[model samples]
Target: MLEVRCLLRSVRFCSSAPFPRHKPSAKLSVRDALGAQNTSGERIKVQGWIRSVRSQKEVLFLHVNDGSSLESLQIVADSSLDSRELTFGSSVEIQGQLVKSPSKRQNVELKAEKIKIIGNCDAKAFPIKYKERHPLEYLRQYPHFRCRTNVLGSILRIRSEATAAIHSFFKDSGFVHIHTPIITSNDSEGAGELFQLEPSGKLKVPEENFFNVPAFLTVSGQLHLEVMSGAFTQVFTFGPTFRAENSQSRRHLAEFYMVEAEISFVNSLQDLMQVIEELFKATAMMVLSNCPEDVELCHKFIAPGQKVISFVDKAQYICCLIISYTEAVEILKQASQNFTFTPEWGVNLQTEHEKYLVKHCGNIPVFIINYPLAIKPFYMRDNEDGPQHTVAAVDLLVPGVGELFGGGLREERYHFLEERLARSGLTEVYQWYLDLRRFGSVPHGGFGMGFERYLQCILGVDNIKDVIPFPRFPHSCLL
Candidate 1:
């Protein structure tokens, strides 16, 4: 039997028999056609599910989607194949000659020499059909098959690209990437929401689990990354994080991914803000260059009328205008969107505000920093001129997602850390975190960006639930 195994990023070669490699038939894609002039007259083998099938009396046109790029491969399958089985979502492989000019909207079309059905999907029950629009809720329920859709496939692809770019940007900057533990006894920064675990088969009591101590899914990797930064000078951790909040908004998910980076011996908040701006700009440029197909999909579905070419051009222009936080706010206020409220300094930004800024202003990308500490996390370093207890924290809000990142310089001084803890009324549960300060500490800073939220920003996806493969939102946790 021919076998196939799928990995998260790369599909693996799965077969019992030795496979023939005659130039390893080039895997032509729907996206390949966009650059088809390069693949002219090449014999290619394309593998994907049929996204949409149009069968007339003379020719059968199958829109094959491999989730490689946002577009679909136009395959001209002859009437020799049974029309009944050649319906939507059927996995198929087409061996054909690539044609550069297809006389259609698509730039490339496959003149199929042969067609073979790898896995047949029933058209009647195919969740994605040719007729009506499906609700987002219904699609979420069928996540296993959601990627077959053009929009979801585009989102996943863009997410993968953005993640790669993140590593590339930081690694190129000489920052070491670290992996933080998922289950640990210590609550790093003493944040309230944690999902505790029980290790010994079952729990007679919460304390009787592993190590006779309670462990929970980590909420943020900032604490451990901070420790690593003390030793390595610069480090980052990109991984999954969980929050047990029960809020059912589209933005909140119980389990999500986070990208965290920490640096040591930073001069002041200005240095932090500078790093933040550079990182966001690099990310935007990276996405624009690497995932133009996915970016087009984002504009098509998430924000209609948003052209990828225009967005990149505008972003570059607006990024120039955003020298200060006040300037960013003013640009956001003047944006052409139906904003429910106005954008101003000291006011916590909403999703609408961020969308306006990214879609309007200079349009490349901007980093709004120096938020009022009252609205930020407790671990941020207190600002010199701010009111009592406010810290030098920053949240990086992007175009589509309001607060894509949350982080700040940690309270390095033991006395100040303890005082802040007591003042916030969270002293009792964080004695161990306090002990880290007592033993040996350094002036360290970092921030956490929700991995899925970052994906949403890049792909122009609206719902947090869509980016994650299996979502764990309030009132729903199903595979």
Candidate 2:
């Protein structure tokens, strides 16, 4: 009788269990709604900050943006639903129905049925004033709030697209993606511009140091990519590189991203040059095709009143011209204009010299190859020219931005590399680097392109700081 009573109680408890509730679907992004067709009469939810608001006696019109696209969605709300807090920079959520718009700027509009304020923002205290065009330099002072501006929003979108295009270019070419270390013992450039790592709040002895001897933030990932090239025929790395230089120029940054690639079994410098040309052209074409509106916005910001051209259009007229370093020197000598730094055989090319060379070639991209050996690093291959003394190094100089890309064939001969390293006082530290050539080294080459510099070139942005999200320089590291 007791067992029968317990069974009845269990059956009653099972019958009283609650059923599972289904979750609501996710909200549609502004970009999705802009591209969608036949969304009329459909109820949708959108959450974003107010870019602009107009309150009228009969109705209220709000321009809302969610950073998904360059254009904003027009929302029409009843006058009764409008509140004083629905000003610029205020965050809110709206439930509305999509309908055909009578305005010419957009094809569709949202008729708000419910409006809820998530966060209220005071218009008088906001740093970004409405309807005011702020200079890029002024915007630099407010990095935290500058992204809400239209100019920065467009630049960031283009930057993101360019990054994706780079990855696609490498993946389609059968290249493997590699991640090199940020903390390394050797400076790849051998320029002695490394940021050394030390313990916090105390001076530790050499034996008690973090890396025991000395570790530094890597100036370049070229050396690590070279190590990976031994196993993978083609490999690349894209990440932040650091430098301790004290330059406060628009071109210099304390930390920046570098896109480096290494290829094995290359025959000559021309093969590597071909890779560089195709990579630039392919990436440019992708960005121009994918983000036309964003690119246009950037051009408008940089060069107002100038007609903006499609990347494909500009690329069609531009051809990659290759000139020997000797020929380039001769050309500079014959130029009618005076240069700040005279174009000598052994001296590295300055920014003015590079821009002049591009202009001399009818404002096109030019690859200046076979630079003097003394001006380059120890890893560059030595050209067999007797008196000229040049190495198989190259720099791709575009019209606006000088020296956009630099690369060369690496020294693969074991004895030659060892001798070069010994002269540079890095033989002991890079004995492992020498081992690659000692065991089995094939002909290889690669190049490094500054990521921010590339965006500045493509988008016509004058300053490198404007292209990057966060600008880092000497005495100026702000949020």
Candidate 3:
């Protein structure tokens, strides 16, 4: 359902046939055929699966859908064309006359002249039946066929538009897209929750360890993007990240996509926060404009009476709330809501704390900055503030989702990085990273946004698996 057109943008197809041939009839997409204004019936060909079919004494009606659009094209034909192969979930090539529809529901409909059954589907065996709104859990069982549903079709199109919008945002902002490596030697997160790779049925000494040293699926693209930040002033990478945590929480995923960016010459957290705020606003607005109808359909079926887009628009209008992590802890302590974990000055913020902070900040996205140094990773820039020590880190928490983005000013000082890595026993391992600080290192910072969480936040989807196709989690990996 996600066309992934950007992947093919650089590929140019050249067909130089020696002899010219007659042009075939124009084949139109469901979106195209629906938007036609031709009152003077023009012949058009549409190929897609049948969404619904109705047989009457003298007339027949069918709704055909292709992934191009969320709405299906209404087809009206004579009852004489009705056949057993014309059941729901069957693939067909429909040649029809496109004419303006008298119904207010849509602008145009098709009057079928010829119906060719390309593939016949047995309705009884098909998991997805006609006119039944299956819950997301049920649809998830049929991972291979769930995309055919209008709900998933809408979600994927939104995802595609969002991906395109994010790419455009970086391009317009003078940020180079870097394709970071999927396998890395270093654990950027320092969490030790990594998926290590080893060859199957291995025995030889050299082949025992594939890379001689263990390799892991990358947990973050921040380190790789930082390398590019040295050359390119602004660089970004949007790709899959892996974590070996066994959490079955709605937010946790074994494999997911991340949108990470690094900016050079950032003197303060204010500069980094500005970029994060703008990225969210710009991407949201662009996706809304690109796929409004598809988004609306998701709001209708998924959230049911929830104004997902309006809430996103409201967040854009109001300024994102900014507060120190100390302020956040104080706010949590003062609140009446009982938290599962106590909110202390140095402890990490739990989901409950994050949600409460967002609500307390007038229901807008809130940025909590300057986390405790001991709790944060080694890469964060040290505050060097005596008495109460912290790092120049920031986390953006939204209403429904906790910690939408996490970033900080990277430790650009050579001595600080060396000492930290030495303490962690990784000095020789990260010689290349140390080399960056040795020569002309600028004060740079970056943040990574969870792509799936962003989709769930915008679409009001309850589960992370619903938004992404072939979701990889602790115990779930469906084809």
Best-to-worst ranking by lDDT: 3, 2, 1
The clash tally of candidate 1 reads 6
User: Alpha-carbon error at 451 in model 1, in Å?
Assistant: 3.1
Each model's TM-score? 0.79, 0.93, 0.93
For residues 1-479, could you state the per-residue lDDT of candidate 2 as single tens digits? 99999999999999898754633423777777666686656778888889999988989999888999898889999888636889999988887787778988998888888888899999899999999989999999999999999999999998999999999999999999999999998888978988999877667665587777788999999999999999999999899999899998767799999999999999799999989999888898889988988888877778565333443347745679999888988888899989999988888888888889988997778999999988899999988789987889999998678898999999999988898889988899999989999877999999999999888778877788898899888898997
Q: What tens-digit string does per-residue lDDT give for candidate 1 at 1-479?
A: 13322352234335445777654567756566546675566888888888788888888888887777666778886776687877787888889888765476977788888888999988898777765556566788787777766667767777777788889989998899999999876666555688888655445555356666777889878777766765798899889888888788878899888888898887576676666666666777887888776777667667665444465435544443333455667777666666787776677677777766655654445556555666666577766564533466666656556667666777778887788789887787677667767766777787777888766666566688988878997778877
RMSD of 2: 4.6
Per-residue alpha-carbon lDDT of candidate 3 for residues 1-479, written as tens digits (9 for 90 to 100): 24666445434333333544533446999988877766478888999999998888988989999899988999989888747789889999988788888889878888888899999999999999898999999998888999999999999999999999999999999999999999889899889999987666545455357787889999999999999998999999999999999998888889999999999999899999999999999999988888998888888888887666688866568688899999999999999999999999989999889988988987788999999998998889999998788899999997678789999999999999999989988989899999999988999999999999999889889889898888888778877
Q: After the best TM-score superposition of candidate 3, give how far the Cα of residue 96 lies from its true spot, in angstroms.
A: 1.8
> What lDDT is obtained when candidate 3 is compared to the true structure?
0.89
Q: How many residue pairs clash in each candidate?
A: 6, 0, 0
